[model samples]
Target chain A: MRYIATILLFALKYIALKLAFVPLAVILWLCWITAANYRKLSLAKSDVELDKIDQMLAGIKDKLPMDAKIGFRTNIDPGRRGVLYFKSTLILAPRILENNDRDTILLIEDPHLQPVLDKNYECLERGGNQELNYCLMRRRN
Target chain B: MLFFAMLACVLVLFAGTSLSLTKTCGLSGPLRFPVAFALVLVILSYGYYLGLLFQIQIGILLLSLGLPPILYLAFEKYKSRQLNLSFPKKIGSKNLAVLLAILVLTIRFNKYVYRWGDWDAWAIWNLHAKFLFYPEHWRNIFTASLAETHPDYPLMLPSLIALFWRGLGFVTPLVPVAIAHLVLLAIPVTVYLALKRAMHSFAALLSLLIFCVDTTFIHIGGSQYADTLVAFFVLMTFVLYQETKVSSNRRLVFVLGIVAGSTSWIKNEGMLFFLVFSFSFLCFHFKKPAVIFRYILGALIPFIIVIHFKLKLAPANDLIHGGREKDLLSLISDPNRYWLIIKHFTMTGITDYWIMLLLVMIVLINKMPVIRTLPFMAISLVLVGYILVYLTTPHDLDWHLGASVDRLFHHIYPAAVYLFLLKFSENREIRLWS
Candidate 1:
């Protein structure tokens, strides 16, 4: 009976020691769990968003000088406007973006929406898919 | 051509940093590469400042800077009449599985990486990089109209990205992406090797495992933010701090000072760390004036440059812009701010820094003697400094804490884990190998 009691005491100490590393074990396990999030990731839709910005820029590539500053105004909703604006800034990067200026490039979110061009503006081109509407302007003196 | 250009950049960087490591610090073979990788970018970033100061083209500046290191190596090779460092032309199969896993993750993560990076990356860091990439209107990048992009922030990340852009003669998304990937992988490997050197192999392995599963580390690392690099340097400092405690090689502590100062070049949080670390270091090492002098000597150049940038070039910080005494009194006197800070600290502590906290709790339960170390004191003081900032933050309490507290923790979590695990060695004693 005494011998069995000694074995029980040792088992308790061993179990406690093992329990000390339970957090570390859980940490290692967490990686496998978290890594599963990447499996659902895809490139199809996001790629189109960036490429649309590029496509819009491609139409005005020759007209805009390397160092010119062009204002950008987007009709996209406030919620998604930041996304559209930043993407456009990168696409036309090295060219500073000025909002609400006469020398401007306009991006209309919906294809149906035509940018309202005033007397000072003449359309350079509109080139983008149904997702984006891009327009370059030549100012009319 | 792209591959060759990138290879040339990496080779040039390796040539410079490897020679630097040979003189400044003694690290083992496997350990050398990660530190060298980090030091190269930092050197390039520092060089950017000098380039701007001299009004020289960045590409010319970098090549001239790199030339000296090559010349130094040539002299060394001539002096020794042989080469001691062997360049490995192939990745060994021993670490192939690990390499393959990292490669898979890199490719997978890039698929999700927005071509412009996440909001802060593009709106702030990479956007600033674009200005440097096209310097024709560089003055406009720092104008009040561009205030939302934080022109006051330090230039390490943007400058490093721009350096590559300047070198390659064109900007590509691949430069920043590759950098982010390498930094993510480097952080774990660096601390792992440092720990293993300190005779804590078990703790080192756990760090690798912990980061592998850390969603925040992976995400922020791939996001092109500087927080992970901040984390990387903090851990490196912690490892080196302990090295000075165990070894008679006092020069290691000097290198630690250099690494610590380099952190300030990365971001404002790094500046906070530099201040707290300076105080903690002095308090702990005050017994030896000689050691203090060595540390200060190392930190002096970086510290002066950052001060010049802050005072002369950069705008006032958002948190501390125009306040004299009223802002501090009101922000601190209000008790609700305290409650909000505590609430967020607890919540974020659980969610974001859980792994590090778990290590802390385990060490406490097992009663490890981690409290006496320099890293423990420095990091604790830095945490207090973070809380103090929260008290006086200008932004709304909820918004301020919600947006930043996690990234704040990211800056120090790995080092915190390293500190606790210093005593979590097999014998449960914080013994460092001499």
Candidate 2:
């Protein structure tokens, strides 16, 4: 009986110790993965373009009389033409022009306001010219 | 130099208190010095806190300059307390040998503090102290409002550290770390005394040695963590509870309740210990229900004060929130996470080894003739209940449960050591070794 008890105790302890090793392994794996993929995504344009983007955001903020929240999403894709994408939201929509490219159209959603696009030549010409892309919108509701 | 100064002040205040308490009790002889010393230390701790309040430089200096003497007094008081209790004057050679072994193991592996992971100490515990030191940045510690990281850990340890920093003229992160070590060292001493009461001195010493050298225990003790403090209070409550049981001193039981409550104040998991003790006391002392109830109330008073301060008074951002919603099953079933926690806990060095020894001693004692089956059974039941608690904790099976298990082990260590000693000393041969 004593021998059996000793054996059982040892087995239980051994299993306990062996079972405790998993979390450490997982933690180490996480640390390694995070370290490998950690890099700051730098926007690939001159300060002027970056400043222009900030100015655009600021201008949109000023033009919208109502308080419209703005947020930005950035992703890295090696093959994409534009390295950076800026999205802006306004309170209301401006008038649309006929030459708008539906493919790159920044969709504006407002229950109260109709969709409008800048078809003047400068806005369209600037859209495909740079490695940076701007999508503008106004929330109507 | 600042650390030494603070130590000195604490010692002096401790000594003064010890002197006063001994004088009041009219207790004299070889025990006087030690008793006086312990009283002084306890007294001086409060005194130092008072100095911090008034911004008295002299008071601060005195408290800081007096800590060593206070510690010396406490050591003396422990010895004196043993002598008064009719304990053997000298420990037997076998027990001494074990003590030496533990001392050697501890000293040799003391460097593990620098080697072992102290991520929690660095990130949470010390970070709280940093914020407390510069209260202007208190907002940074309340929530991720100032930073993305969570700030919801219990504040007892950090608050104590803050108090020490404010009381002293300087700051060193090591102050709180040192206090943790001090509490760790005190656990064996307290356990030794409690065990001596129920068993032979030699058995008590052997148990102390085993606990001192336990790998996990030593690692936790040395770390800037609250586990050791929690363990100390848990042991204190158990010791006092046992004392009340044997002597029927309701006051001792009341005191035990306060200590039990303080355990909860130290950490959230302390509530588990508090509940276990309350249940144990209620069941054991059911015939005297009113006495038990009063003791429970005494314990709850201090606990409530601490809880009120933490939840209501402390900044809202620092309050741990997401705990209200948790999943229990994941903590037990997740093998990968659970094992990682067990490994770290077991590898805490010599302290873990001691816990293993304690487990063996408990088993051996169960076979002994002198131990009464009832109390032993009761303690075992409580311990099993604690383990079940670990199993049912609403934490992720892998990581959270594992981490909590480590903390829970610490909470019960003192009681475990005391019970092991009590059981081992049942043998006549072991008793004579003292």
Candidate 3:
């Protein structure tokens, strides 16, 4: 009777030890699934906006001159332009992007800002949401 | 034609002149490939510094650097020395399939999610590389206009990226993107290789799976920050140190030095790592002054480049410049500051390294020893250094913690996992060097 009790206790301990890893494995699986999904889901909203900006910048890559120091100006919230600035800098390389919009030969600014460009200086802006949103622009001067 | 040339140049850069030396130093098997790739990044950055000094053209500079390696591959030596180094067969087909699947999915998801990579990827690291691509305007990278992007940071990661861009004669976003993906892949694979080499197959796979599944690891590594590079060097340096400890060859300590010194060349936090690593290594082998001298001798090249960059080219770091405004004593004295760091670290630990931590506990219960591994001391010291930085930082504690704490953990995680598995190894009397 004593021997049987000892064997039973040992088996129970061994089984419980193995059982502990079962929850951990499950937890890890769930964590991976949730974290991956959560990040993907959370990013789902901004991904579209980023893709639109990417498309806008990429479309104008050839139009920008090499070695030109360009500036990006957008009426799209003072807060949001940081992303636009970074993206524009990357998409258009060797063409420097100064944070300032003044005193640059080329600028990639909002299409709605024609009044600002027209009233402020001698410059041209063309292109948009499709062809000429003017995410790409070069002034030949 | 230049693209093919660039590919050949890259092959030479990673697997070039030092193959015979590395193999002799006991870095055999597939492990040597990733390790060699990392060492190449360090050497490439240092070589770039020399090229810039000499006003060498990028194309000419790369071609000349490739000469030795190209010769090495062409000559009888490389073929004669080539041992069979196929990927680990012990991983088995099914495990290999899972591993490949995980790598592919993580990379694809990262691409879908972080197309341009996380913020610092473009704004800083790749931005620095772009400047280097325009060799004439590369000095403009250090101008005061780009102060916020940390021009003071070391050039290892950026220099590696620029080598490809400069080779191709154009900077594409794909260059940084591709390099980042490779580094991200290398981290888990390094963990797997290290453990598998130790004959702990189960622990090895577990580490790989956890790393692959952990979105934090993927998100940050794929983000193209210098932290990913720093993480790799941190693990690499520890591995080199362990190899130096176990091997009969005293010369391996020199390679360990180069690897440790390369840490500082990766990022500013890496400087802190170099200091801690040196201090920890010194504590372990205090009696062996010859080994220490050999280590510092090996460290000379990368360390000199780092010093020259800091003094000549790079601007003052913002943290040091900003700290003058803050009341440092009060921040240090405050209990809440301590609490904030603890809280953030704990949360990250629970989420990130808890599995490794659990296995560490199991090992402790089963066959506990009083002596901690050298990594234990090094990791603790580095963590303490990070917390100290947090206390003194001029930025809002909450904001700074939110932005940086996860990455700080990520940098330490691979090394920690490696250490945990080393501790968990079946060999009870593992002589981990001091």
Give per-model CA RMSD.
11.5, 18.2, 11.6
lDDT of 2: 0.49
Best by TM-score: 1
Q: Give the per-residue lDDT digits (tens) of candidate 2, residues B62-89.
A: 6454655566566666866732222233
The residue ranges of model 2 lying beyond 4 angstroms of the native Cα positions read A1-141, B1-9, B16-106, B115-117, B135-140, B144-152, B197-199, B313-395, B427-434
Off by over 4 Å in 3: A1-73, A91-96, A105-120, A124-127, A130-141, B73-113, B323-326, B359-367, B370-372, B426-434
| Top-scoring candidate (DockQ) | 3
Q: What TM-score against the true fold does each predicted structure earn?
A: 0.82, 0.55, 0.79
Alpha carbon lDDT of each predicted model? 0.71, 0.49, 0.71
Query: Chain A TM-scores, one per candidate?
Result: 0.58, 0.24, 0.47
Place model 3 in a CAPRI quality band.
Answer: incorrect
Kindly list the per-residue Cα lDDT of model 1 for residues B119-151, writing each as its tens digit.
777777787787777655555566554565688
Residue B144 in candidate 2 has what lDDT? Answer: 25
Cα deviation of B335, candidate 3, in Å:
2.7
Candidate 3: Cα lDDT at B1: 66
Return the interface RMSD of model 1.
Answer: 10.6
